[model samples]
Target chain A: MARVIAREGQERRVDGIGQGDHLCLVYADDAEQRRVVTAYVRAGLSRGERVLYFADARAPREVLGWLRAEGVDPSTALTTGQLSVTTAAVGYLAFGAFDAHAVAQTLQAEVSDALSAGFTGLRVSGEMSWALRDVPGADQLGTYETAVNAVFAGQPASAICQYDARRFSAAALDDTQRRHPGTVELAPLHLNSRLRVTPSFRCGQRMLRVQGTVDHHTIAAFAATLETVLGWPGDVWVDLGELEFIDLAGLRALAQTAARLPAGRRMHLVELAPLLCQVVNLAEFDDISSLTVTARDAA
Target chain B: MTDPAGPRLPSSRRLTHQALIYGSDEEFLAATVPFCLDGVDQGDSLLVITTAGNTDLLREALRDAVNKVEFLASEEWYGTPGSALGACHRVVDQQVAVGEHRRMRVIGEPLWHGRDAVETAEWTRYESAINLAFAACPAWMICPYDTRLVPEAVIADARRTHPELAVGASTRSSPDYVDPAATTGFWERRIAPLPADGDGDAAVLDFDADLAAVRVFVARTAAALGVSPDGVGRLVFSVNEIATNALQHGGAGRLTMRLAGRRLVCDVANPSRRATDWFLGYRPPGPGQERGYGLWAVRQLCRLVEIDTSDGVTTVRLHVDLD
Candidate 1:
């Protein structure tokens, strides 16, 4: 009976996700996908829920391997029928088509079967790229996603719809994002009313993406995030493409982080707004050898 | 008097602020051309901020030596007293860091033709402040005041502001000179009050401990007044800094915003009656210094920033010109 709704401009943590929550995860790359999938599967299995994954971009064995790497033993669950991993072709595009009502019925049946089998409920995750294969009625993916909300409503069932940002068109991503009530984001290093600092690892690079304002009210969060990111191995990159504002205190936090970086490791600031670029330059942050700033052209 | 090497003004390792009063083109060139050439001879980095006419005259008079000096028009350089102070500090700091120059010599002529009473007073305060703001840097600045074009009252104020007065080839200590520490308090005591919000059209917000709401109020209000996106960004930044200070230092505050002609004015007032420093934001913080940057940045971002404390309330007024 747990329902989670992510407010606009906010994201929900994967661990805090509950039954009756319909979440969409737009992953930047394979590393990010593996991390979230492992956490989601582990969370479900620990709670005795029947965990299901419909893998499209990754093989079923590869998905299980991620669970094993994250210290979750999927073998017992797989053997006991408490966990299932299949291709999206078999699970979603069954019978050569995707119909919204049919998918809703299929999801409801799974939830019912899990309860009858003595498991707590059902937790499902599907890699959504298979819909792009031109299968019959595949264009109804949005309809299916929206319809499944009712299938999970007041029921012990939840879902995570995964879309790879690299392959999906902007319109598709936007359409899918609006159909879900929540989004699965990694547990942020920091979050407050005015700012969100979410961390991600892609292509072996640690990154922190900042969104919203970083001023006196939010400098503590921003500074703390920078401190956490700096503690990680290798160089760090902060993506500020969605950042609406950052003040002197925020800049000071960045400077302090850059200064604290060990020799040979640099803090890379990418997609900085033009106004912020002016502020950084005025602060003379360029003097910090460990820091590099690149301004994204104004849209 | 036509030594071509300029008057041998006192050369101090510390800052030397002088007023060069000239009545005619001959006198202006006679003082400035020699000042530039002499600074160049002494390996000092030279910057000349003056009227377009004076820039041309100095350029012609210096001939080959003019290339060694950086020239900026006064209208563009003197955007506000705070900004002008920031600009001068940058020039001096850059020169000092390069180690290629012994000192920085500037010919700064403030724009005074179209200023109101408040602006005139602020500019006069700026002249006084240069004495303290650059007291540590090896900068020798000459503020040129044209007797015919500048108001007689402003010309009189200049004598009191500048520690040294230069007329043609003669240089002498100005008996009218007042120390910045003394004048700063005097100016603050006599600081002009903002015009009455007579129309009741001004947007007002009472804020306490909510810096974010303060920012939103300023941004929306400035945009409603037709401030450009960039202008709105700057206004929000400036106002947010002041409001944050108000909340932290004064416990709470109120904000009033109104448009005066094409310029947007925002005043943040708090009940804390502590004496505010008139020169708080003039000097930039040193490298790696954490505090004191908020106010400095506010001055840099806004068109004009005035701090007034009177009648049991302290107010920080910020102005931004709308596009």
Candidate 2:
């Protein structure tokens, strides 16, 4: 079980990294990420671990400059084969697309290679900003992150997965953070709760647009927003296109909300993933005598 | 007319088909009670399947022998001829196993009132088909018709179905009784033939793999027929099961949907060698069973479910009441 290694104060430093430790660093800007990465890499180098950084949002030379600013000699580390900085295109996208198992296997093999080459351990940090380009299988990024927990367990390796919050949806950020055992928040701007629920009236109909996750942490906000929407005029259309994940509790909340609607108004759930559709269908939500809940794909 | 409580006379017959035509409740009792009592005296299994009104009458007449007889609810147990026959066979098999070769008596009174033309036709065919259903078994069945309530045509159909007629306690051969196979053939020939185009009010969907389209089509058709919102969903859920079963076991199939009076009916026909068994969907699925709920859900949701097999094609009819 890896614990949080970053302190909650000014000059936050990432430390205490050991074998089988997996950490995530979420940032809002490249300028703020430098301090966190520099501290993280220096901690590994001081422990004689081979450092591998897959940079995508910034060039390798620019990242080296950041390391130099942290009082580390980049030229010496580069020449001594102790550190390697490569672009995301060459490192993460070696297969031209990301597959959850393939990525995890590749990283595991790399860790084994580093251990065989006489390094005490392997330290890896990859910038996930490349996922914003809509690459095939990018939607599996969260699944890959979750898989890494088993990959690094009891292995002589530690990983810091960096994601630029500005380049990803709050849902993606929330999902990524939820999968990692530890996270170092470099910018407080993106630290807000990852749930945005808004209710409004459109053409005499009550409507709600839901984004991010609807889990235990954000169910209350969802319930409150739903109540506000139900108070408005005729019928309801809930656009769930932006909703990334929903738990059973969240689904129950929706069912209860629909049950309490005014007479003659129907609730339409539009644009749900296939798995979500199966969950909704299996529940027989529309069979509730008091409510008219219809699930359909957006026309 | 012979005395209702007259002394019993021993008889030897392979399969006894007796139809009792009665004018009043007393007459119905006189004819049916003797048949049931004779079975009890012979130490044979007796099963009485009839309406609640007649069940009470027979229970009182059976007196102390009521415990020895088994009564099944006719409304729930009798749906289509095929299903009713299936239920009768199950009861007969159980009773026969207990009685050995003593004999088995079944008094099946499938109500002939308030049924639509389609149901009436089906029951009429059932009456004829039962001869074939029990030809090889040593079962004595007495079908009672209320002369004051049942239509004249129904009585005539009964005459054609049974080999003998019973009034009071007397039995006589029926001139109208045709061979069981001939009776079965006559009724099958009278069933409404499938349309040549198969595309009038009925929309034909040849479904081999896709189940979603079946659901969508059922929903749209049910909604158009003014089925309640909950009814539409339930109908879709149930029809989805039927379509799935047809695809998996019934082989290549086509679903035909149309409005029959105030009811929405969908017929799923497949080129399978066997018909969907009657008891397939009428019972709860057992533990660890994965593939039995499809037809059972259909039975739960639809108002009427019937299966018929003819000339290598199996058709399952799903009827949802619009009112």
Candidate 3:
């Protein structure tokens, strides 16, 4: 917020607050909340601003339908689905809400997306239409701004910058280093919370493109994406140079991925994970090796 | 009782043929598939037994050195000679039937273990073993180093020991001992050639697994396929793995192979299972790695890997290109 204000020389309100690029709001409600929030967003739509909406899967369709009728294409808005609390938050960074409504049944939960859903302090600091309810830590002074900045800056792939211990678990991170070669690391601050996430579209040389641990949890997504990317009906580099852990599940996923590719597409593994290399040999996967991954030089 | 394992029922087909020997041991391995190799052939139901289960030595001689034995279990015969003979007899009887294409081959280096092994009275037992094997043996050949030590009287008393095989030990050559009286099948050669060359079936091969023997077996097959022996030794050892598995599991299974197109396609099917991933031919790390290493070895050496398992049928095929 400060960078945006400083760089743009935006005016600060006399109420001891800085003007910000984005605005958000939170409120505690009992009922009749929908009418109020929809009105707020309708105001923005009437102003002819392209509004983006973000909400849980079962959010009220009427509010979104109203926005769509006003002209925002539904596809442009992203869905975080039911990702973890932190992931949902990072998604929010990209998927900032217009007049979105996310209502959880229980406010406090064992594993709820509440930690990353705070919008409590933006009302006085900036001017924007915000109508959220019982945001976990909404009353904090500048906490909301800082959380928003995290996603705006430190762009970890797929991970929404909130907090997580796995980000810098000495053992897991160290293990990653042992197998992978790299120096500069923006490690997680703790077990569950990341330092911050500020995503950039820039594909930088300093980017440590990591090969993720391929397990049942991620195999389908991994393979389908690989296949889709390869089947782009045009040229695309499905770079897998930095993948680390690949178990049997991962191997099968890769095999399935290669099998699904259009024949003679020239797929290459380009420095495949150790176990994947073995799968290639045993299953005669090389029969379509040109269309999948190929081992690349170890740098 | 008599050793029931010898060529019993003479082949109604009445096929007569000469021994076909290739120049190299590997050539013999490739050209010598069960049911037919060069001038020899075994029927579909072929049982193989080998007392010498030295996998290392067999690898050196067998064509599918590792891939052949990759997925099956293999072990040396630890039971008594009599029981081993009994086992052989049972295998023969179980497979060989009247008008059935049953053939069994038993190969081992002959050793005078004790009086129990080569006693003159044991001739009946030896004859029974051969009779049982040959009863179903479409065409059988045994490569025992010396049966000469066993007295002629012992062999004579046996049910079907080649009575006229000059009844003596190593006086001349270690002549191959065969009895056509056991499951003889006539091939009308020029008149009635083979069944169009590609009647493929699952097969199992169990042989005395000596590394040298393994090498000998592999070299025979390689030479038959006419592939230049440049770095093919690895392929040879790879195929041996399947053979080792057959030996350890099937007790006796034939190495059934056919020359399909440019490929010397062979399979060593066994009634055993080794569920390990060995796509890279290296020393398998498990207990069965010796033969379990076959899958990995096969993947490395062959052009294709086709494994079909259904009901009780398991076949592992490795195609070695002749060109």
Index of the highest-lDDT prediction: 1
Task: In angstroms, give how far residue A20 of model 2 lies from its true place.
Answer: 9.1
1 or 3, greater by TM-score: 1
Best by DockQ: 1
**DockQ: the better of candidates 1 and 2:** 1
Cα TM-score per model: 0.73, 0.43, 0.24
Tens digits of per-residue lDDT, candidate 3, B99-166, equal: 45444333332233443321322323333334333333354443322233434443333213332221
Cα lDDT of model 3 by residue, A233-275, tens digit = 3222333444434433344445555556566544334455443
DockQ scores of all models, one per candidate: 0.34, 0.02, 0.01
- Of models 1 and 2, which has the larger TM-score? 1
How far does residue B141 in candidate 2 sit from its true spot (Å)?
Answer: 1.3
Q: Which 10-residue window of candidate 2 chain B scores lowest in summed lDDT?
A: B1-10
What is the per-residue lDDT of model 2 for residues A1-299, given as tens digits with 9 covering 90 to 100? 11111112111226655678787776655666887788888888888888999999789988888878878887777887879999888777889897888989988998888878888889999898888887988888888999999888788998888876556665676577668776663332111256666442222223465667665456677777677647655556675766755644466567677778888776766655444564444344444444443343434
Better of 1 and 3 by lDDT: 1
**CAPRI band for model 3:** incorrect
Ranking by lDDT: 1, 2, 3
Chain B of model 2: TM-score?
0.67
